[model samples]
Target: MMPSLERASHWLALVCRLVAGIALLALLTVTIADVGTRYLHRITDGAIALRVSGSVELVSYLMLFSLLAAMAANVEKSQVVVEAFSHGLSSNLKNRLHGVYLLGFAALGLILFIGLLDSAAAAARHGEVTQDLRLPMGPIYYLAAALSLLLGLRSLIHALLSAVFGADGEVSHGE
Candidate 1:
């Protein structure tokens, strides 16, 4: 890869990681606040209008963003693995198999990315919005599509590296 492209990829990955972290923190905060507000409202006989509107929709979107944003990093680290049947394989075979698996995941990610683009376009055309908050869904879907594309590219790169360099290319966590 060109140095500039490599740097860009690194920055994108970092941004995604940051987004994931923020989403998780926001999700936790929102959950706690929502629960607390509901409890207070119940005990106080509805004296305080502290119940957050559209919280459920917000949380759902946050969870989706968090999961999507973390995909590239997780793929790079080789965190998702199927070990049920591969425990007895030789190291060399295992690495090759994993490379193949990553390639498959890349293909799946590509499909998802394309599908998400179409979904986003359709949502925009229809002016679809969250039921409670009326927040447009198109932009969120576009973001997810972009992240999925990134994940697909990352997975493809990792698969190629693993195929070429054997065990050195893959990040193994002893799982």
Candidate 2:
């Protein structure tokens, strides 16, 4: 990877991770608030009827975004290697194999991004909205599609970098 592209990927990864963290935090906060409201409502004998309306919808959306937002960052690492089988292999080979795996992810992400863009357009045309909150679904689908595009780009970049430079510090070491 070139220095500029590497830096861009690093910054993008940071941004994606931050987005994922924030989404997860929001999900947790909403879930806690919903549960707390239920408990309070039960304990107060109908005195406190306050509830986070459409919490399930909120949680499901948040969870989807949180996971999706991290895909860009997670594509670089998080490989599962059953070392018992192939620990003896060369690191370059491992990196190349990992690159191949990431290539597959890149393709998958691109496919999903394209599909999501189509879905977003369809939702906008149909005037779709969340069942409980009645919030427009077009924006949500568009954001998901954008994130998937980012994931695809990141995966493609990482795949190329890993394949060409080897992922085990070989780039820096000139190996």
Residue ranges of candidate 1 with Cα displaced over 4 Å: 1-12, 79-90, 170-175
Ten contiguous residues minimizing lDDT sum, candidate 1: 166-175
Q: Write the per-residue lDDT of candidate 1 for residues 1-175, one digit (tens) a residue.
A: 4333345546667777898899889998889999999999999999986987888988998998899889875675663456887778777776667777789879978998999999999999999987899989899899889888888877776676565455433333223
Least well predicted 10-residue stretch by lDDT in candidate 2 = 166-175
Q: What's the distance in Å from true for residue 40, model 2?
A: 0.8
Candidate 1 local accuracy as lDDT?
0.77
Give the C-alpha lDDT of model 2.
Answer: 0.83
Report the C-alpha lDDT of model 2 over 18-76, residue by residue, as the tens digit.
98999999999999999999999999998999999999999998888889888876777
Quote the positional error of residue 84 for candidate 2 in Å: 4.9
Estimate the TM-score of every prediction.
Answer: 0.82, 0.91
Please identify model 2 stretches exceeding 4 Å from their true place: 169-175
Screening candidate 1 with a backbone cut-off below 3 angstroms (N, C-alpha, C), the clashing residue pairs are none
**lDDT for position 67 in model 1:** 90
With candidate 1 superimposed using the best TM-score fit, by how many Å does residue 71's alpha carbon deviate from the native? 2.5
